[model samples]
Target: MLKQTANMQSSNWIGHFIKITAALTAVFILCETVLYLTNPNNRWTLVANTSLKDGISNSLVYPAYAVDVAFQDVEEYPLTEPLIVNPLPNIINDVVLPQNDTFLPVHLVRFYFGLPHGDSHSFCWIDCISILSIMLYVKPSKIYIHTNYPDYWPFGRCDMITDWSLIQLVYTRQRFHLSGRRITFYKHEADVTKYSVAYQYGGIVQDSDVFHLPKMVELLRDWKNKKYQCLLTREDHFMNSGFIACPKGHPYTHDVLLRYRDDYRDPPVLYNSADVPWEIYNKNKDYQKNFFVDYQMGNHSWDYKGPIRYKEIPAWHAYWHGCDENEKNTVQLAKNSTYWEMLHFILAEGRKALIAVFPTTVKP
Candidate 1:
């Protein structure tokens, strides 16, 4: 009878141990999920203190890897991913556009473009010229060209960095998701960073399509001479980002860029690259009095109304649909601007097919 009692006690002890082990495992998993949701940027909190006045690129964990992580993992972990800013190259060559990156409190300008990791592609000829032209037109004290392919921008006129990592770090640091619904895309990467740069550095952030015009040149020069904390122009409703200027560490930029996700999530329309920053302006009161709705500053090369002013001088030009290749637009383009000038682009691009089919004769 004593032996039988001992066997029963041993079996009960084994069952209790199994239950304890399973309970501990469940607890561990629950704790991990909580930690991930609460502190998505990780325990490090690297970008929380990013005054942005002093870039901490030197401190990026693995400079290049941060960009690689953005490209690979953005779709999976949009808001919570941790990213590092790649270090800027030590030596900038002379051929670069502007001589210095003033890193000034204000009068800085930034632009963004998407390219493959390296300089392997044809690197669209119009984009090359248009981008360089926009920078010169702004005449900024400091210029930042945000791109995935830094290799192509070696000339040193602009400080080139990976915008992908920049935007990711901003979202994670700001906890931007709480603002409402967070959406990520090829265009948002450029659009969001424009806000970040304006908040941190206090400068202009323009689109790649814009070009130099006298009005834009005058405004940029004004920032250098005296007291202009920030300047943004808007149409009746839309806030045009083609030209924006701000004082370094502006409160407006902080609220719009960082705290946005905390209050409102739904924008009437997405802030896609083509449209304006209307979402932020509409939601935030601080932005209204500080920024203005100016016709000249917000003027487009071609308005929704379509009284084409391409031939005339404007603050900045947006060749908005330079890519439109419809057969009908071909003749209208010739009437509006210099369509005949681009017939060469067609021949240059289709040379391989043209040669394969008509190898015997040269077109007379």
Candidate 2:
């Protein structure tokens, strides 16, 4: 009787072990599938077709927000060499572009916001650092800033960031924080129309909150010589104004700014428009009547036509933006992700250095 009881116990233990192993294996497979399917690059269909656009003649082709996946793959298995950021040698040739200097070099710009006015200082500062890490990595030539303020405050306090001169460039602030920066931003004016007046030549504009990957500058230089006068970025099915490139004084710059301003005037009845899916800007009533009218330049739809206008360039960071916790996590994860690692390699030898960040609310 004792032997039989022991045999039963052994069988039960083995059975439980097999069940546990199977469950773990299933989970591993599921996780891999999820990551693969959701990867932004894997879904190439999400990007607009490039073949239809005209190529720049004698101009260097600067790619926007686009990263080659193979480059990222190689970076994952880096050799023992110490990691350092450096510019690619002969970037003009490596990127496959003829040199043209008639056009001024384009500078891609983005800004960083810590949090809404009323959020906890800890949360807001963490948010600011998360953006700062990526900005330090990109080291852009121009930066525009928008934040909240009591107009002035003690150093280290959350509202202290309102001092715009700290970050430099053109600065503005919202009247209230609870207004939601996006809504408040829509209410204010955009500098797009003032490109000619503000800049000697046109430069690119990128939303400050987005993160970047490697060799982005090379891509920008590559297309500079191209005939296209402007470039727009897309996130899957949506076209985003967040990333834009135009020559100084280009007509499109003024057009886009004027259109956005008009939209802000009456605003699309946003409260009634929540049902529109994320990234579908055209479907929004305000955008439909104004921004989406022209399909060739890029319509209101998320997935517009290929090879944007001569005034338009391809945009890469179309999939990410805004301040939701999930969006913020993705941005943070990217801070240490393989994407930025390659950038660290490419950025190691660049000339630009750290600049002071000023509060936006304070006037010069």
Tell me the number of clashing residue pairs for each predicted model: 6, 46
Instruction: Return the TM-score for each candidate structure.
Output: 0.47, 0.35
lDDT of 2 by residue, 165-260 (tens): 334332222112111223344322223212222222344454433334334444455546553445554434444444455554343443332333
lDDT at 334, model 1: 51
Error of 1 at 221 (Å): 2.9
All models: lDDT?
0.42, 0.33
lDDT score of residue 349 within candidate 2: 20
Candidate 1: clashing pairs of residues: 96-155, 97-157, 178-261, 179-261, 179-262, 229-247
Best by lDDT: 1
1-364, model 1: which lDDT tens digit per residue? Answer: 9999999999999999999999999999998778555542333323221222333332232211122111112221123322221112211222122223353322212222323233233223333334434433553344455443334443222212111221211121222222234533334444555665554345565654454443545655555564344566665556665556665545555445543333433353344322435666666665665554446544544533344332243344444534334334455555545422232222232343335556675341
